[model samples]
Target: MKAAFLIPLLAALWPAHAPAEGVAGDFDYYVLSLGWQPGWCRATGDRRDARDCNPGSGRDFVVHGLWPQHERGWPDHCATDERDPSRRDTQAMADLMAPGLALYQWRKHGRCSGLSAAGYYAALREAAEAVRIPAPFDDLPRDITLPPAVVEDAFIEANPGLTPDGITVTCKEGALAEVRICLTRDLEPRPCAPDARRDCSRSRVLMEKIR
Candidate 1:
């Protein structure tokens, strides 16, 4: 009877197991994040070294990542049997994203997609190509301060099938940071999950000029 009581006390003192992260290939949709290059460079002070921030780089909105999302939460750094991307593979994506970012995305979000590194990058490219960048953002001759909603509206107006519910504009340090658009597994526009639909509430966010 004493041993039984001791066993119960020990069990009660043991820590509870943390919830497991989502498994590979088990997410609801995708979030294609496009980073505003100038804003990112300004906010993070990466202009001195980042190739994407270099003058004459001509980069405006670059593919940040294509992430697997749940209806409620998201997943990251999932375990996968697929091999990590090689330098050649990451370098091939330099036109769209920095090589380091390409490799990191493959490790974090891509691993959850249950695709090989090659297949994941291919899908990322396909998803990015499907979205149209509003022409106005192409050449911002001067810094502009506008409501975040205006940016979202521009994207919605440019992409026929995309609605406000399918896209969100995020800001960092009162500057436009990223434009995240939800897409189906097939890369079609879709409504974002409630948790993923949070937009930047800033009244007027700065948009740095293209470098």
Candidate 2:
């Protein structure tokens, strides 16, 4: 759905920094640090799912970054109508967002995002939607391979109590760096609790289930 506006502009740019005593890091997917999502933010113009009267839309995803800038806002003034940035708590805006921009920046018109040597923030919905298809990269159908056992056999032929987990992927020379999946169902974690998230379609039936 237009990638849903990069999920509320990256939940309003991670302004809440609370974790600095005994230092705990490594939460992965759902916030708590480890910023960035998804390689250059994806979405570079598509718009074809608007139906019903022929409106034709869906493809305006964005998540550009530069958190904690020097007070003036708009990442030190680029447009200034305030695209994103403003809660007022400065340490030079948390030391200018602490990093060298890589992940957050997926636009599709007037300009797009680039640069990601893969140094930081690159989860990218595990590849897309439900997650899976990793390992020597065999699923090469392209257009962004998102085949976790065909979405768990189309959700067990359309919900039959849904029981499908067990994924494991690992490709070498072909590609698909590495991927380990897990599942148990019962989830909804978006913006907040739904059991705090889990069923990634049972982690795409556990990566891609070869075992």
Candidate 3:
């Protein structure tokens, strides 16, 4: 369904009372952010979690979060009522998320998505599947250094629907952290808003090894 139609249809079917922070479904599109796991582990060093840091994990980018964002601002934790995510919903996202991230993401961001747990997660999975990981990035032979723009270009080149403005490269301590891609709620590429576009000021950043 078109995002324009789906948002209003959802709103009418299940009216959401805005939380103290802001109204649910007030956002314009979604940001499907994928974290470079090795960079994350290396940047944090000792603070790394077991799943992502496991030496033989053979993982590269992992789902960071699928966020609902406005053109200029973001709404988070917008649900007035809290409910536990079903185990089925949590398990459905397990392959894409690290341990504990599924729950945290649902509470912190998904609740504000104006979608039921099943619908929201299904959309998230679809968005993640829509993008193709650029070669070498999908499986890096060794740690390499590249400009943030290069990383963004790689993704844009790999994913037919993406443009430079539709994606932003994020870094932490000069290491590639995440690639945040803007998409309409229905999962079509679009330019990220100014707020979502702001990130990683460094001229170059490290792309850590995937072992």
Candidate 4:
């Protein structure tokens, strides 16, 4: 997953300064960032999460986190009413989320969702389940190059209720990085924030193979 590595890398690179406080339930929508695992590992380094990068895993997209977003910038570490997931809750979350990325999401985004720890995570799972991966990406195993708009169109065609405005295709150095989808708090497809749209300006983006 791109954000699976991106968030942690960004956190490491972020300045060691006090972050702004967040206001609970103050956002407009949610952004479910699904990372293209192989694309990230290739850019970051070979020494990546073995479970995800191993040649036989056969997983292309992985849940990075279900983040709460605003019309402009987003929120993080809202009110310190944070609660760690319990053992049982952790097990349930693992069913849909990456283990390492789970805690970061809770601390950074989940805490600001204005829902209980259990409720927030449940929403994370719900958001993930709501989207249907396009057939081309449903079970990717080899690297493929594609145009960002083409990928976005595939996703829109696969998901009946989704539209171009509902999704964005992110790229890194002309490589497909992630596909960010926007959804309402209740999990229905929604248009993404103008700023949250994909940042790639290239005609072709490389999607590294899962291996």
Candidate 5:
């Protein structure tokens, strides 16, 4: 009877331990996150020090990350045999994301992509180029408060193939933060996974003006 009882108990516990280690390049889709530069600088109090936050940077929305996503969950820090990115490799992405972020993303998410450092960064650039930034955000003269859905709608309107279900807007401290869009491995738009479709439900959120 003890053997029978132990067998059921172990079966119950197996699933909890099964997915602790993710397999590289084994994901269902991708999430391309675009951050609002002005909101990030204001929220983080990064005035003149950071390159992207400095005056005359002329940046609005910048690439935050290109994350591999499962249909229901995500992976990170998976074990991989790929070589880590060199300093020069990371620096090449400075125009879109910080060098530190490029390095960190490579170690955490990129390693799980089953791509070499060069291949992963190249894919990141391709993903960023797939989305079009809505024009209104380029010339906002002052702060504005709007529902996060409006932001999602703007992105959908700008990108011909993107839909409301494929994009989400996130908020931070009652301010507009980032927009996350779902894409297939080939970089085509797709509906986000249930767990990944996080919409900021605030009735209105602050969108800081460009500095």
Candidate 6:
């Protein structure tokens, strides 16, 4: 009985490739840099003027957030990245930063060397947990119909672990679906989510329909 349960348990907890070590932390920092200040800037609001609200276009992605919805990408800047980073190269963000923007980086975690904990981490954890199986699909409402991107993000949020190195989406247990997502450099920190996650409410209806 234990073996039977353990098999599915392992499957539920497992990732296809296990991200590189130490790089998980690095990838996490990358996520942090993005969530705080996303790099992608597409022209939003006022087509007549078509002014850049975030101005992510042509820039490397920097911020992403699930709070105001992850779709907005990075608008808020971290307290540390704003002040310092592991290596200082103004060329990377000359257009974004001012002549004297405070710059700081933790080097390992993209945080400053020493500063009080901000609990801002509470959000990034979502990205970490999204990379797992049997995540919180039933909790979200089915009526909402979350997009694949949102569902994938949720899986990583629910079950975070050792990210892997390879990147591909093939048919697994369910023959459900697949979508290409931008992966990390070496699959450290194992950013992965389950094959399927729907608005919990919608999944419930699906279950009913199946029944």
- Measured against the true structure, the TM-scores of the candidates, in listed sequence, are 0.88, 0.19, 0.85, 0.84, 0.88, 0.23
lDDT of 1 by residue, 1-211 (tens): 5998999998777533222386889888999999998988876748367666778767789899999998867878899999999999999998788798899999889999989999999999999998899999988878999988888999999999999899998888889999999999988999998777746888999999988
Error of 4 at 155 (Å): 0.8
What's the distance in Å from true for residue 52, model 5?
1.8
For model 6, the superposed segments whose C-alpha errors exceed 4 Å read: 1-88, 94-145, 148-187, 191-211
For residues 35-106, could you state the per-residue lDDT of candidate 6 as single tens digits? 111101111223433223233332222223211102112113223433343223423433443212222222
Per-prediction CA RMSD (Å):
5.7, 17.8, 9.4, 8.6, 3.9, 15.9
Location of the lowest summed lDDT over 10 successive residues in candidate 3: 13-22
Question: How big is the positional error of residue 29 in model 6, measured in Å on the Cα after superposition?
Answer: 8.3
Against the true structure, candidate 4 reaches a TM-score of 0.84
Q: Top model by lDDT, which number?
A: 1
Q: Residue 23's C-alpha lDDT in candidate 1?
A: 85
* Residue-by-residue lDDT tens digits, candidate 4, 73-130: 6889888565777767766677666565787788788888888888888888888887
* Residue pairs whose backbone atoms clash in candidate 1: none
lDDT of 5 by residue, 127-209 (tens): 99978999989767789999898888999999999988899999989999999999998889999987777658799989988
Candidate 2 vs candidate 6, TM-score winner: 6
The residue-by-residue lDDT of candidate 2 on 36-107, one tens digit each, is 112112211114231211222111111223121111111211222213222332122223232222212211
lDDT per residue for candidate 3 within 57-162, as digits (tens), equals 7889889899998776688887645465777779778899953788788877888888776667788889998889898687788989988999898888899989
Which parts of model 4 are misplaced by more than 4 Å? 1-20
Ranking by lDDT: 1, 5, 3, 4, 6, 2
